[model samples]
Target: MTPTAASERTHLVFDRALVRRRLARAAWLGAEPFLLERAAEDMADRLAAVKRRFETAVDLGTPTDAVARALAGHAAVGHLMRAAPLAAGAPDVVADEEALPFAPGTLDLVVSALSLQMANDLPGVLAQVRRTLRPDGLFLAALLGGSSLTELRQAFAIAESETTGGISPRVAPFADVRDLGALLQRAGFALPVTDVDRVVVRYSSPFTLFSDLRRMGAANALAERRRVPLRRATLLRAAEVYAERFADPDGKVRATFEIVFLSGWAPHESQQKPLRPGSARMRLAEALGAKEVPLPPSGDERD
Candidate 1:
C-alpha cells in the first residue's frame, strides 16, 4: 500500500504537522521557562542513579532545551545530541518521532521529555528507539499521563454541553502507566518500568491555565479537535464551571499534570529474566510456611 493509504488505514490521533507548527510558534514567541524543569531534573537524577556512562545519547523531540541543559557536563553522558520534530529548539537535528534518523544499534541512550505524549504513532516510535539502541542501552522518557488536565477536560465538557448542546475533544488523550509499560515490552525493551508523578498546579483562573498551555506548546492538537475558534460564551461558561468545581478554598483553581516516567533497556544476554513458570524448586506453600488446602472438584472432574 502507498504511504497515504497506510496512513488512512491507521487511526491517526494527533495531527503531527499541526503539533510542529504550534511548537514553532511557541518557540518564536518565547515560551515560558521551567515548564519542563521538574521532568528534566528527574531524568538527570534517574540517569545519575544508574552507575554507567553512555558513550552516545540523544534527546528525542523534547519541546524545550531543558533536558539538554540539565544533562550538560554530566559525568554519565558523553557526546549527547538533541533531535526535535521542528526547528524550534535549535536541536542537533530536526527529526520526527514517528521516523527516527538513527542507524540500528548506534545509540547508547535516548531520552524524551514531555514530548512523546504528542506522538500519534507512539508504539512505532518506541520500536524505532529500541532498534536504534545498542544491546543493554537505556531509554528513559517522561510524558503526560491519562489523568493529566482532568480539570480542564471536565470544565470544557460541561460548558460545551450546556452552551452548544454538544462537546468536542479539547484535551488530547494520554496513555495510562500500565499501557505504557506494555508498549515498552512490545518495543523489545527489557526490565520495563512505569511510574507517575502527579503535579497539581494552582492557577488564578482557567484562562491562566490556558495561557500556560499555549506557552508550553501543549494546546490542543488532536486530529478530531474542532477547527473553529471556541465561542466566547462557551469560554466564559467553562471558566465559570472551572471556578465553581475545581477552585480551592483560597480561590486558586487546580490543574493536574500527571507526568509518567518510563525506563527500559535493550535486551542483552546478561539482562535478568523472569524464571519459567513451575520451575521453582520449592512449592509456594512450603516457602510461605502455610498449610495447603485443596479446592472442590469441578463438574467434569467430579463426573
Candidate 2:
C-alpha cells in the first residue's frame, strides 16, 4: 500500500497526549533511563560498524538525550540535534513523530532510541522520516516489541478474569519485527533490516516492576485502556499470580522486554537491487550439481 493509504489505515492505538504527559512526568520524577541508555549504546555500536559518516543527524523524540550523548563527537557523526516531543526537554526542534518539520532530502541520518512505539500512526511517522532523508541517508531506531511485558499482561489478565469476571486492556500493544520491517519497505526505504533484542529484568516483585514501568514512561497509554484503577484485591492477586508464574528460585520475578531494531536507507542508485525474474545465467540444479527429476503428469494432463 501507498504511504498515505497505510497511514490512513493505521489504528489509533495510543493516546498521544497521555503519552506526552507521562513522559514529562517521568522526566520530572527522574525516571530511570537504563533502557534508553542501553538502546543508545546499541545504536551507536551499530552505526559505528557502518563505514560512512553522517554530516547531519537528528535524535528523534527520545525521552532524554541519551542517544544524542552516545553519538555526539563520534567520528562517524556530525552536527547532531534532537527533535523532542515536549518543550521541557530543551530540544533543537519541537516536532511530533507523525509530522516532522524537515524539508525533504535535508538529513543524512536519523536515530530514535526507545521511541516511536507509542505513535498512533507509526507508518506515517516512518514515511515522514524517509522523506526527510537524503539519498542513501540512514534511519535507525529501537522500539519495544510485541513480547515486552508478557508476564505482566498474563498476570493482569488472570487476576481480572478471576476476580472481576472480565478483562480490560491493561498493557499497550506493540508491533513485531516482521510488521515493522514491512512498514520500512512501505515507507520507501531500501535494504530494510529488522531484528530483536530480548532483555530480561528481574525485580523483587510485580509492584517493583510497576514502579519501573512508570518511571520509564511506559505505563499503559492505550486509548482503550481501563479508566479506573485496578481494585486493590485485583492488584494483590496479580502480584501473587506473577510471583507464582514468573518468579525465579530466589523469589524475584522476571520481566521480559523485547526491543526491536530497524535500519534502512533512502532509495539511491548506488545501492544494491534484486535481480529481475528469469535473469539468472544458470539453472539451480546445474549450480548445485544435482540431478533434476521430472514429476509424473496429473490426471488432467494425462487425459
Tell me the TM-score of each prediction against the true structure. Answer: 0.94, 0.93
User: lDDT of all predictions, in order shown?
Assistant: 0.90, 0.90
- With a 3 Å backbone cut-off (N, CA, C), the pairs that clash in candidate 2 are none
Task: Show model 2 residue runs off by greater than 4 Å.
Answer: 1-10, 298-303
lDDT of 1 by residue, 1-303 (tens): 423344456687998888998898788877865648999999999999998899999999999889999999998999999998654578888888777888999999999999999877787789889999999999999999999999999999999999999999999999999999999999889999999999999999888988888888888899999999999999999999999999999999999999999999999999899999989999889999999999787676653
Model 1, backbone clash pairs (residues 3+ apart or across chains), number: 0
List runs of model 1 lying over 4 Å from the truth: 1-8, 300-303
Predicted structure 2: lDDT: 0.90
Q: After aligning candidate 2 to the native by TM-score, how far in Å is the CA of 153 from where it should be? A: 0.5
As a whole number from 0 to 100, the lDDT of residue 51 in candidate 1 is 89
